[model samples]
Target: MKVKVVSLLLFMTGVMTFAQEDLKEREQQAAFDPAYTSYSRKKPAYVTLKDGTKIEGHIKDVDRKKGQIHRLKIIEDGKKKVEIQATDIADLYMAPSGLEQLDKQANFFNDATKWGKTDATKHLSKGYTMYTNQMVSLKNKKKPTEYLMQVVNPKYSQVIQVYSDPFAKQTASIGVGSLKLAGGIAKSYYVKKGEEIVWLTKSNLDEHFDRLFMDSEDFKSKYEGEKFKWSLLGVYILDYTEFALDAQMGEAK
Candidate 1:
């Protein structure tokens, strides 16, 4: 009886150890798999079509081979899955979650005018009007000014340094110049204000804001003291727009 009890305990221990090892192996494999990594970062988002149809789902994957998100896999209604090309989506909104709570909700629009153009412009609007990880606002309903903030600098770059040795021997070293690409390096603000496209920088921010909130003393008093940082420009714009919209809604009420 004692031997049988010990044998049973040993069998259970072996099974537990095997299960833990299997789990650890799976975790290590997942870490090395790009698909697995992308899947783990999937987030809830909503895609809107040009015809005013909205589809809510989890963005499973973003195909970004050409420096932009060209395709997206969305799991709709919690189970119904669909893959959408960028051309089909008018806009995409990604919800904030967990550590992303500090980040602004991502909103991208499709700029139709740039479609089928060549050079960097072709990459600009493959089918979608806007780039990922950006904020968009329609300031005027009657005139409809689309306010957009984008990063102009490369997200990543590599620096290579070569040295010549004069003391010992002469040698030649060949290095490959590989391009590193990333998004949201340098910030640029653009506004399509009533038939004109205006680029806003540090110099013009004050002028634009002044014109935008000409009658609102409250907006000026609250934001005038705040220093503008490039990294936080999007957040500031989003907050200011929300505040102005809220104030307008309140006045209407």
Candidate 2:
């Protein structure tokens, strides 16, 4: 009887160890998988379609390839399961979920400076993340393609929208010439105004800066008076957006 009890305890311990190891292995693999970007835990979301249809559901799964969301699986009304293609979705708003909370916690611990990388921190309750369909040109591709773009700043999307470019190439100039070399992962940004969306870079930012911020006297004064850092471009855009919003509100009043 004693031997049997001991054997049973050892068996349980071995099973638990194996389960834990399996879980860890899967997680490590998932970290590198693009499809794993989606939350395994379903989160509340509102999706708008091109034809003006609105869907209220919990997002179950997402399929992404090369940083673009191609498909989504959502549970609607708690019973019906629906699969949606990214092309059909005009936009989507994801409510705060376990995944987003985890992201916040990780960001908070990793870098205090990045805590407010976007205005999402101010409007956490509104929507943790938002995506919109936009025309984007991938690296090495000549033609632009329509894809689901994640909006980095949503505070004043009406005036100008900021998107994190997932398809950006991790390339850097090799020498004095325009010769480039591919390297580790890198990020690029894009700004959209009305129907025009352009990849934003330090070199081309000058061309678009005036047009984008011409209406904002506050931005013009700030830009001219202070030494603006290229790294803080998003901050500058946000400031201009605030000014734009204030003007619109004043006019409305």
| Best prediction by TM-score | 2
Candidate 2 structure quality by residue, lDDT tens digits, 1-253: 9999999999999999997776444323212101123443455677888998988788887787667777888888858889998889998776533443322211221232322244233334443567788777654254787777777655345578877666555444222112122342223567787677888766567777777776677778766766554544645665676677667777878
Q: Which tens-of-lDDT digit does each residue in 1-253 have in candidate 1?
A: 9999999999999999997776444322211100011222344565676677778777676675313355778888647779887667665654323311111111211222211233223322221122222222222123432211222211100011011111111113221112111221222334433334344444466666555443556656766776654333333433444455556667878
Output the number of the lDDT-best candidate. 2
TM-score (C-alpha, index-matched) for candidate 1: 0.33
Q: How close is every model to the real structure, measured as TM-score?
A: 0.33, 0.61
> What are the RMSD figures for all models against the true structure?
21.7, 18.3
